[model samples]
Target: MKVERQKDEIVVRFSAGKNASKIQSILDYLRYEELTSKSKATQKDLDLLLKETKRGRFDKIIIEMGLDEKDYR
Candidate 1:
């Protein structure tokens, strides 16, 4: 395997006998990093967003199951 920096991008050259699944997982991570690199949100913002989303889903589940709100609260 060989790696080089080409302009603002990276070029990785692997011989034919590479593990495809590991390469795919690495590519997926790089794609995620690229997608979030310009984000302005903080960790606190993500935590609150996750909390609210979880609460909303739980609220929906409780209504569907006809469970008492007091039981969950």
Candidate 2:
């Protein structure tokens, strides 16, 4: 795996036969970091949000939006 930074973006390249899922996970994290770097939210805020999400805190909002967990399941 290799990483390079361009003027406004980062590029990642991997040789063939690497684990696809792991590469995808890394790419996802890098994309998230890039997107959040321009936002005002701090790591603490993100941690709290992730904690709440894991605790089903947004279930009510999902229901209100007419989205059911069963649909996803």
Candidate 3:
């Protein structure tokens, strides 16, 4: 594993091999941290959002907003 800072971005490099899922989990966590750091939401708000996501509320929200997979494709 290797980490470096380039300008305003932090870069991480690693060999996935048999640990691809673990690496992806770490990356997902880091991405969440980065997003929350720049947002006004509190930890409680984030926790609630995560809980709702786990319950698939976001899928319903997408439908409410008239978004569909076909829109992306």
Per-candidate local distance difference test: 0.93, 0.81, 0.81
Predicted candidate 3 versus true structure: per-residue lDDT over 1-73, tens digit per residue: 8999999988889975999998889889988897878788788997998997865866666778899846643
Q: By TM-score, who's the top model here?
A: 1
Per-residue lDDT of model 2, residues 6-54, tens digit only: 9998777889775988878978998899787779988899899998887
Judged by lDDT against the true structure, how good is candidate 3?
0.81
Q: Best candidate per lDDT, number?
A: 1
In candidate 1, clashing pairs total: 0
Model 3 residue 40 lDDT?
Answer: 82
**Model 3 clashing-pair count:** 0
**Model 3, residue 36: C-alpha shift (Å):** 1.0
| Per-residue error (Å), model 2, residue 63 | 8.1
Ranking by TM-score: 1, 3, 2
For residues 1-73, what per-residue lDDT tens digits would candidate 1 score against the true structure?
A: 8999999999998776659779889989999999999999999999999999999999999999999988998
Candidate 3: where is the Cα deviation over 4 Å?
A: 42-73
